[model samples]
Target chain A: MPSRASEQVINLIEAGLRDGSLKAGSRIPGERTLCMECGVGRSSVREGLRVLEAFGIIRSSAGTGPDAGSFIASEPQEGFSRAMAMHLLVRSFNVADTIEFRELVEGWSAAQAAHCEDSAQRDAALAEAAALLDRMDDPKINQETFHDLDMQFHTLISALGGNAVVDTTLGALRSSVLGYVLAAVKQLPDWRAEVEILQKEHRLLLAAVHNRDSAEAQRIAVQHIRGFAERAKIGLQQ
Target chain B: MPSRASEQVINLIEAGLRDGSLKAGSRIPGERTLCMECGVGRSSVREGLRVLEAFGIIRSSAGTGPDAGSFIASEPQEGFSRAMAMHLLVRSFNVADTIEFRELVEGWSAAQAAHCEDSAQRDAALAEAAALLDRMDDPKINQETFHDLDMQFHTLISALGGNAVVDTTLGALRSSVLGYVLAAVKQLPDWRAEVEILQKEHRLLLAAVHNRDSAEAQRIAVQHIRGFAERAKIGLQQ
Candidate 1:
C-alpha cells in the first residue's frame, strides 16, 4: 500500500527524459531488471510502466524475449492530446470557450498560411482544405469519418500556421471538443442544412485566405465557429 | 509495492467529482477514515491525497482533530496551470514557440475585446491595460514587479476575450515563458531601450483597442510579439 516506490520510479523516468539519458524509441529495462536496479518490487515496477503508458510516454508489448519490455514513445502529439482531453473533461470546461479559442488560433493560422512566407506549405494547406470541402458533398461519407477529415483540414492549417505551440494547443483543444461536437450533431433532426452552411462558409474562408484577406478570414472563421456552436446546442455548461 | 491503491484512490475521487458525491468546499474524511472506506492502508490513502493535492483536486491542512482532514478543493485553474507547466518542462519546449503561441492567442483576444458586443467588459479591460501602460513610466517600479503587472494586463484582455480555454491556456503559457523572458531582458546591455520599444508598441496596440479597430489591434499585437521575440534574439525555429 505504500506507493512511494511508484512515485520514485516516475521521477526516475522523467529525470531520464529530461537529462537525455533516455532518447525517443529507447527501450526501458525489463520489469525484473527495473525491480533489481530501482530496488522495488516487480509489481511496483509494472505499475510505474502502466502509468507511463497511460500518459502516452511509453509503449508496452508482451513476449518472452528481451525486446518484450517497455519502450519510450515518440508520439508526443498523442500524449499532448490525451493530457489535454483529460484535463478538459475533469474540469468540465465550457465547450463554447473551446470553440472560441479555436477560432482565434485557427484564424491566425489561416492568415499566416495566406501570407505564405513559404509558398509550398501554404499551397498544400489550401489544397487540403479544398479537398476536404469537396468530400463534404458526398452523401456516403459517414458522420464519423467526415468529422475526422474535418479535423485533418483544420489541423493542416494549424500546422502551416508556423507556430508549433499554437498548433499543438489548438490541435489538442479541437480533439477534446470532438465529443461535444458529435453529440450536438446527433441531436439535430436535419444535419444537411447545417453542413451546407458550414461548407459555404468554409469556401468563402478559403477564398479569403487565397486572397490574403486577413480580416475577412478572421471574420468568417469566427462566424463559422459561432454557427457550429449554435447548431450543437451546447449551453454555457458544456 | 502494490501502487494500484493510488490509482484506485484517484479513480474514486474523480468518480466522486463526476457523480456529485463530492461537492466543492466539502470536507473529506480523515486518513484513517479514508483508509477504512477505501480498504487500503493509511500510507496508500496519504499518497493518493498527495497526488490529488498536487492536482489541486483536494486540499489538506496540518492540524489535529476536526480541522485537519482533507477538503475537496474547487478551483481547477491551479491544477490546470501546474499540469501545463509540467507538460512544457517535460517536452523541453523552445521558448520561441511559447511566445508565438501566446501572441496568437493574445492577438485574437485583443481583437475579440475590440469587437466585443459586450462593451462593459471591453471597457473594463481597456482600463486595466491602460493602467498598466501608465505605470510603465514610473522609474521606481522594479522590472520584476512590473513584469507581473504586465502579465495581469494581458491576462485581463484574455479574460475579456470571453473564452475560459483561451484565457487559461494563454495564462499558463505566459507563466511558462516568464523565466525565459526575464533572462533575455537581463542579457540586454541596454535594457531600457528594449523596454521603451515594448512600451511604445503597447500604447499603439491599446490605442487600436480603444478605437475598437479589431484589425489594427490584431496587427499591432502580432507585430509587438514578433518584435519582442526578435529583440530577445530568439528564432522562430523554422
Candidate 2:
C-alpha cells in the first residue's frame, strides 16, 4: 500500500471517532492490541499516537490498566493559535492587511453583539473591556501584556456576538497575529499616545454597544483598526 | 525530557526553515545525520519526517543515492490547509457558521479586489469568476467540483484583495469548511434551484466587480452567502 502504517492508524482512529465506535474521553487500546487490531507494528502504533497527541486529538498517561492507555481528547482548539501565528509570522503579512482582516470580523461581531438580547452577556463583555482598559496605566506594563489584553478584548466582543464560528475564527486569528502586531507596536515612536487613542476608541466601542448602536460601534471599530494600521506603517519604514 | 523526541525533531526542522538554514527545495541530511545531530534515534527522525511529509513541508522520493533524502518543499500553504482542514472537520463546525464566516471575508475581498490597482490581476479575477459560471451547467459536476469552483472564486477575490494575511486566512477557512458544506449540500432537496440562484448571484456579484462598484459587490456577495446558509439549514433539517 502507498499509505504508511502510521497514517493508516490515524485514519482508523479518526473513522472510529466519526462513527461513534470510539467516543470522546474513552481510552484507546494498548500498544499490543492496536498493533494486532490495525495490523501494524508497535512502532507504527506509537508513532500514530504521537502524531495524534501532537494535534491534541488524544491524551496519553502512564500507570496501569485503563488509566495508562491513550484516550481521545476534547481539545478542539488548543493548537490553533500556535500553528496559525507561526505561519503568519513567517509569511510577514503587512499590518494593514492584518488590521483590515481583524476589523472586518470584529465589526461584524460588534454588530451582532449590539443586537444581542441577552443583557447579562452584554454587561459581561463590557466589563471585560473595562478591566483591560483599567490596566492601561500600569507602570510596568509591557508589550506582551498589552497584546494579550487586546486579544481578550476582541475575543470578548466576538463571544458576545453569539456566532460561535465567528468567535472561534476571530479568536484564533487574533492569537496568531499577536506577535507580529506586538513587534510593530514596540517599534513605534509615539506608542504611548497611540495606545491612549486606542483605549479611548475601545471605550467608545463599548459605549456604542451599551447604547445598542450597531452602526456607530461598527464604524468606530473599523476606524480604530485602520488607524493602527496607518501608524504601523511608520514602524515598518524603520 | 518532557517533550517527545519526534516533536523536538519537528521543531528543529521548522526552526531551520524559518531561520533560512533550510531553504526551500534544499535536501535535508539523511536519517543518520539527523539522529546524530539532534541526539535522537533513527526512529525519531523517521517519525519527524513523516509528520513533515504529511504536512507537505517536505517531499521524499524513492532512491538509493544522495537524491533519496527528504527535500524542503515549496507551497507551505498546502500543508497549512491539509492540517487545518482535518482539525476543523474533527471539531464538527456548523456549515451555517462557516458560510457566515465566508460571507464576511469574501465580501471584503470582493470590495478590495474591485479596488485593485493592477489591471492584470483585476482582469484575472473577473475571468476566473466568469469561467466558473461557464462550467456551472456540466451534468457530470459533483460536489467536489462545485466546491472547488466555489473556492476558486473566493480565492481569486481574496488574492485580488492584495492582503496576504486575509488571503491566507480566508483560503484556509474556505478549504477547511468545504467537507461539511459538501455533506450538507448533498442532503438538500431542489439542489438545482439552489445552484441556479447561486450562479445568478455569482453573476450579479461579478457585474458589480466589473463595474467597480465595491459597495454593491459586497452587498450581493453577503446576500449570496446568506441564501446558501438558509438552503443549508433546510438541507440539515431534512
> lDDT per prediction?
0.71, 0.72
Task: Please report how far candidate 1 places residue A162 from its true position, in Å.
Answer: 3.8
**DockQ metric for all predictions:** 0.19, 0.35
So what's the TM-score on candidate 2? Answer: 0.83
Off by over 4 Å in 1: A1-74, A90-92, A115-145, A199-220, A236-238, B1-73, B86-93, B111-146, B160-162, B199-220, B236-238
Q: Return the TM-scores of chain A for each candidate in numbered order.
A: 0.84, 0.85
DockQ of 1: 0.19
Q: Write the per-residue lDDT of candidate 1 for residues A111-170, one digit (tens) a residue.
A: 765665647767777887899889987977777877778788778765765766777777
Residue A131 error, candidate 1, Å: 6.5
Judge candidate 2 at residue A117 and give its lDDT. 83
B197: Cα error in model 1, Å: 3.5
Per residue, candidate 1 scores C-alpha lDDT tens digits across B123-238 of 77788789888887687777787678778877876677677777778778878666667767787777778778878888887787777899998888889888887878754432
Clashing pairs in 1: A95-A238
- After superposing candidate 2 on the true structure, give the runs of residues whose Cα lies further than 4 Å from its correct spot: A1-3, A17-38, A92-96, A119-122, A234-238, B1-4, B10-42, B45-49, B52-72, B140-144, B234-238
